[model samples]
Target chain A: MDDRLVTAGLHEPGLAVHVEDLTVSYHSKPVLWDIDFDIPPGVMAAIVGPNGAGKSTLIKSILDLVRPTAGHVTIHGLPYRDQRRKVGYVPQRSSVDWDFPTTALDVVTMGLYGQLGWLRRPGRKDKDRARAALARVGMEDYADRQISQLSGGQQQRVFIARALVQEADVYFLDEPMAGVDATTERTIVKILHGLRDAGKTVIVVHHDLQTVRTYFDWLVMLNVRVIAQGPVAETYTAENLRRAYGGQIALLDSAATLTPVD
Target chain B: MLDILSDFTLQNVMIGATLLGIISGVLGTFAVLRKQSLLGDTLSHAALPGICIGFLVAGTRSLPFILTGALLAGAAAALVVVFLTRTTRLKTDASLGIALSVFFALGIVLLTMIQNQGNAAQGGLDSFLFGQAAAILRSDLYVMGAITLTAVALVTGLWKEFKLISFDPSYARTLGLPVLALEVLLTTMIALAVVVGLQMVGVILMAAMIIAPAVAARQWTNKLGVMAALSALFGVVSGLVGSVISASATGLSTGPLIVLAASVIVVTSLVFAPETGLLPTALRVRRDKFSLKSRLVLGTIYRLAAEHGDPAYPAEQAMIDAFHRTDTSAVLSRLEQRGLVRSTAHHPEPTPHWVLTPKGLEQAQTPLDQSGETQ
Candidate 1:
């Protein structure tokens, strides 16, 4: 194992995420169209877009979960393969079968797998970190509960806890607050803020527009286009929201624009 | 069972049962984990055509040829599943159903074709339908043992990868795990287990070998590690008990006997095992619901009382106010019955101080935990 817990002093400046002309597809049908961007360190960024606007696909493309048909993604200036342990991913809640038999603690410990490398077992340190991660989300007491026993908010918290245990510099969360209870949503925002304050960049695929002001500083409003990306206060104007959800379908836009982005 | 294990025939039966048990126990865990228990059954039946084809091509009983045939057939079945899922609007379970019927029907056709030929090589062909492990040659046992060993090692080596992919494939891919390759590898290993054990355990009842123990052991544990270990132990016992019973009996098939024994274990676990067993789960559900109802009553009163100045309400004549309950009489009766409050005929107004009793408060204060909570 590398045992390089803190990469701050060792890493070079200028890049956290580098997506160059990335074009991903599902069975040859293009989902992400030539996404090109560079995210600097420590910004709490939002990929705000309408549903099926390739928000999830873009995140997956970066993780190598959904391989791009064209272009590439480099995390910490290295391929996902090279920096496997450097990037932590919090997928949509629907990604897993909650009915699976596992504890919250057990699920969070899975984050250590990338660092554990292979056949070697998770030791006391892994368990300790996993517990701490759960505590970070106020779920330490619920660590022993079956994952299925959690409410939508608690489930999202457990997943954030899992990602937290990874201790990666670049955190990508896909709709972490979707369907989450209000308390969980607030806790997730606080945790992300902490991550950003610690010099770790957190990119969230957020659906809520109302909270975008309070939740993030950097915004990338999208609607099959890069609408804007900068400080939330500067870019989250009525114009940007309109562009992301589209003005053509004002009815569809009305309901979507009201989402609590923060 | 002890006396039967002492007999030479029973002893052979015991060894065969143990080997079959091992194969099923190990492979069945993956089957259940993948939610392909029925698929295992389909592949078991699908292996028959391979056996018949193996006999046809080699003109003799060749374990390797038979196994290869079975493997190909199972692979074919899996391919069919993938193809259906990809090409059509058919859902996964629907695709699985189609694969099961098509593959099993093909096997049945092949078996009938071979039997119609009337070759002496067909003598033991029917045995494949319901295995006679006592008639198993030393070479056959060695073949099965080697395959079982390989399957076990493969599972161990890929344990983390399999768990990662099976539990959350999208995350596994993000972590740079080979999701597709791992899926294919696990499927191949499962298919091989079904192919190898089908001859000894038989086609029809072989899924029991793969699923029964895993399902049964699930009652005893919630952790994947513990469940896998218990499943293996249950499988071994199912094998051992089934073998001994068959060994001691006359004109009884070892395969059916073993399957029956394993089924017995599953039944016992389902009904009697503590904690997550069916009976316990049902009891817990009722208890939780009752508590929830009691809490709802108190919570409603608290909210309503806080909103209003006093706890008093019109007695007997009004509907359950603010309860959303259509019948106020039902609500008052239950509350009065529980002695949380009472109504007087002299006053049309209900009793004041509608506060929770000690028991009532306890139920209302219970923390709500989702069934999906992790331990």
Candidate 2:
């Protein structure tokens, strides 16, 4: 696994996530086969892929939400199970029922549940922290509102706030900008960048090729397996994209448009 | 009713039924909202064989022994449903159906064998199938109270965990919650609830006690805590009403009566509850549609008047109909009532001409402005 990480060109000492020989199969069909990658610490990375490209499966596998058929995931040189407190996840907005009878503040406070452990309820301190996270996402005013009453953007922001309150070293966001408004996308991007600036790693499973360069500094282009990965400047080229998207050059064209002209 | 209440056995039946109602209502909220009501049905049916096994083991009619057997059987049935859904290609509905039928069939066979044994203790074993609330004893009340208190305490203690798991199990798992354990624990809780309800509502009707109140409560509130509380209240009320009604008539048993009472609450809540009730929601939709049509008509006229540089330019009825693609006379009349639009007789032709009032113009454009800003 160390050799695989080195061969993948990751020579960094502080790594946020190290996934090696990760192969996940669903009902005998392999979704992610021998997926290997090591993301350096404190970098905003995007797991870019087309639809049904195992982007979500990869994140779930890393978090041990889905057991892998083979291989293991590590966070900062330790297994994910041992380092769960150091990790946070923002699942896709559609992953949960929005009409669930919970307020925005209640949803945000769920981040602290991992720390609070079983049977102990969240206290005033946890609530204040949740409030701060909500304020960070510009959703403090919506804390008391039922989650279903919030708009799509506000709901997405609330989800981000929930992840924010975890105060983990590595944040994994699955399709954070999938169906949000432009303002929400910008706000989320700013929050991600803020996490990176604060010396935390933010790994996002992103689909919008147009925002990849703008929102992410590191890149993991995957389609069933790792097609190419490294700094966005060197690896986000047309060739790597063509290999990842296969027969979808229109996506490449839009991606190229997002690249700033020097 | 007074005479029946004075009887100690009937009094015990009432207390036991009410406690059953309370527990079922509390846990049923989770079952209903989580789309696991089918599991409740499966578990209740599955408790039958457990009752026979308990009778066979104890060689006597012991409330604790029989209910313990029922709880175990119900939990095993729930586990089987979970196992089939998770480990096989079978879906939840199919698994639930399979478990419910198989366990119920096994229970019936065992019950018949027990009946054929000619044991006096087994005379009322069949009562657990359809419930004989009149057979409830003081000891049964103690079991019901203990189970109810335990369920309430567990629910209160693990409130957040249960809520999170119900809403999003995957996310809860990601947060390092024992999702599987929590789920199994919840299944056990439901089984316990079903066990306590068996003597009052019967296995056949116990599922209703675990479903109807929660569903009825869902119609009344959108908050989980409030929903659970209201469900408990509904369950208690149904229990009391069913018990009193059954006591009044020698022909009636408390099980079906309790179910009927709960079903009535569900029906009443579905039809008339303030927020998500069918009537209010339908009315809101109708009102919104009417207002939307009125705004569209007013906007069309305002646009026409703007084009012609006159606030009072009467919009042609033909144009309004074409724009709305529906009858606009009713909306125009409604608008007239609100002083947003009025019929103008400035034209010589008999065609009704409608013009937007200043208030109507503002009203039409207000929503448009808000929609624009929102988009």
Candidate 3:
């Protein structure tokens, strides 16, 4: 890591992402309770947990889309809103209807929309950047293709490409590969790893155990509570797997949920 | 025919048809993709009160005021949908029904109230109940054209944003899209299309104007761009034909005629188009059935040959007894025609037995792995 990257980790270590005594409630029920953690800048981390683990809630609370009942979340010593553009988010597949009219390339162009603010059109340079992003995901051929025609893996790649086009420092994806085939799953993992290599912070809400050790540098075990958050080498363990996947239903179901974040 | 183009009235009607076609096609694309076909209906019905109110309040036959009211009320309907989805436990269907019924009934009551006053403005307002394409003045046509052009430009220009949010909203958000704002913009666009179309098709026919072309085009193409363009063409053609037919006779309502033309296109597309069409798909299914029987017979022959290390299996009696689970007559007849098996009425086991020739063996060997994957 360069001095800039190193200095970023130290001087803003406390400023990185300070969740001071954060608690979140939904419909009168506490989903995330009094959580405190510091996320160093420019590191990829996986938030792993069982169903209803409040993994997505923690992220939404940080984004201010969800209100925290107690405490506050800050980014680089600034309020989340102050650094809103710096953070990019990817939701699970079910978040939007696929039959929507836009093509894959059109979707990637939306990354520039944040900076464009509103009502202002994307210029030639913006179009070039969108095309470049599509090429990066090897989806340039399908750029003009309707999103519905693409398979699960192809769709996920298009989404990741859109996030990359944002040029934001922080990226968050929620259950990106819930029902993708193996090849696509592998390609997505490789791309996410590449993002981390490029000195960006990547946080994924993941359920798989196998890929955590190899794919993620940092791991967060959440089960309506923060089970652990640290280096995968130290935090991801057999005990943690059991802790995360409580009340085992069956091997296949657990394995399906256990799809690695990479 | 060439001189008709020179005629101002004919020119205005033609221009009106083209504008309505383009607007409905563009908006209806989103409607169909979103599975909100009924939403188009709801907005159209809701526009009636807006048109009536515009007439009563303004006390003039101004297109702008009537359309403005329609646009605002259409947005109100969209907001109601959003509110129902966000705040209440009531489903979208129930809320749409409520909005459609309440707004339409209020519009009827308002229309009646305005009628009781017996004002001249109400004369034009009644025309809005069912669209009067002939009543579309040159000024009204230009306004409609501008809105149509705006819709076309926005949809094509911001194709990326529209696509990302519609296909996969969550992913669009991660890339920093303002999901809520974009959603509102799309709904507003749909409303604007309805507003622009209200004059040409009338409020009652406006919903079909958006939906019919879209439905017809979907039967022809899967790609959004192609579907949108085809839908626009279908709409323009239907509008033009309906207008011509209505002009040909007395007591002919252009709205119903236009809808009938669009419906005819829809029916033809459903039955004839290659992909999702009924006729082609049925033929394809039949072809597949024949191929499936052939494959099954080939499989049995190869399996029997492999088991016995012989080219032939026992006669038809043995086949009927062994593979009685399925109807084996087709397989037997097919094998005999291919000259891959031999059976005749000559011996004690008189039925010719099934066998695999070299060609049959080759055919069966391939695609078994493929079959497993498919199954």
Q: Supply every candidate's count of residue pairs whose N, Cα or C atoms clash at under 3 angstroms.
A: 39, 0, 10
lDDT of 2 at A34: 84
Quote each prediction's TM-score.
0.81, 0.88, 0.79
Please report how far candidate 3 places residue A221 from its true position, in Å: 4.3
DockQ of each candidate, alpha-carbon based:
0.51, 0.64, 0.32
Model 2 clash pairs? none
- For model 3, residues B184-204, the per-residue Cα lDDT tens digits are 877888888888777677778
Of 1 and 3, the candidate ahead on DockQ is 1
Q: Is candidate 1 or candidate 2 better by lDDT?
A: 2
lDDT tens readout by residue for model 2, B1-375: 577789887788778877988899999999987898988999999999999899899999887788889988988888788789888999999999999999999999999998888888777788887898888778768878998999999999999999999988887887889998988888888998988888888899899999999999988787999999999999999999998888887798889999999999999999999887889889888887887777777889989999999888888887899887878889889889989888886647778888888877777668564743211
Q: Provide the TM-score of chain A alone for each candidate, in the order shown.
A: 0.87, 0.93, 0.86
| Prediction 1 TM-score vs. true | 0.81
Model 3 DockQ (Cα-based): 0.32
Interface C-alpha RMSD, model 3:
4.0
Predicted complex 1: DockQ? 0.51
lDDT of 1 by residue, B40-131 (tens): 87777777777778878888777677778888888888888889988877977888888878777877888888888887777777777887
lDDT of candidates 1 onward, in order: 0.76, 0.88, 0.76
Indicate which candidate wins on lDDT: 2
Fnat: each model in turn: 0.69, 0.74, 0.38
Task: State each model's C-alpha RMSD to the native.
Answer: 6.8, 4.9, 5.9
Top DockQ: which candidate number? 2
Where does model 2 exceed 4 Å of error?
A1-13, A247-262, B118-120, B292-375
